[model samples]
Target: MNSEEVIALAEQGILTILLVAGPLLAIALGIGLIVSILQATTQIQEQTLAFIPKIVAVLLGIVVLAPWMINHMVQFATEIFANLTKFVG
Candidate 1:
């Protein structure tokens, strides 16, 4: 396809990726921030202390958000596939 079409497709793909990943990343970030604050207060320098909560939060986020994420990804994929002819030709 033309450069404009290719760029549009790339933009859509990026937006889809961000939409799918944003929540989980936010969860991890929030958990990490909290853990950091707790560790600072407690004077605990254990790396696992920081790592475990972020992992758990991200997992829980995934579990909770899976359906929504899947729906968005499916919609994006469907749109891309449906427009494949236009992209290719």
Candidate 2:
């Protein structure tokens, strides 16, 4: 493919990745922040205190957002495949 086409594909791929992963990452970050604050206030500095909640939040985020994420991924893949002819000589 040409440079512009390659760049477009790359941009679409990155956006798809961000769309799929953004919610879980945001949830994990928020959970970690809250857990850190709680640990600071309560002096319960156990590592698992932060770790477990972030994991749980991410898992829950994934579970809750699975359908949307899958839809985005599928759409992206469909677009890429549909454009496969343009990518080849």
Per-residue lDDT value at 16 in model 2: 90
For model 2, state the Cα shift of residue 2 in Å. 0.8
Name the best candidate (by lDDT).
Answer: 1
- Highest TM-score against the true fold, candidate: 1
Q: Write the per-residue lDDT of candidate 1 for residues 2-63, one digit (tens) a residue.
A: 89988998999999999999999999999999999999999999988888888888999999
Model 2 misplacement above 4 A? none
TM-score of 1: 0.96
State every prediction's TM-score relative to the real structure: 0.96, 0.94
Off by over 4 Å in 1: none
> In candidate 2, what residue range of length 10 has the lowest lDDT sum?
45-54
lDDT of 2: 0.88
lDDT of each: 0.92, 0.88
Q: What's model 2's lDDT at 34?
A: 89
For model 1, the run of ten residues with the poorest summed lDDT: 47-56
Q: Clashing residue pairs in candidate 2, if any? A: none
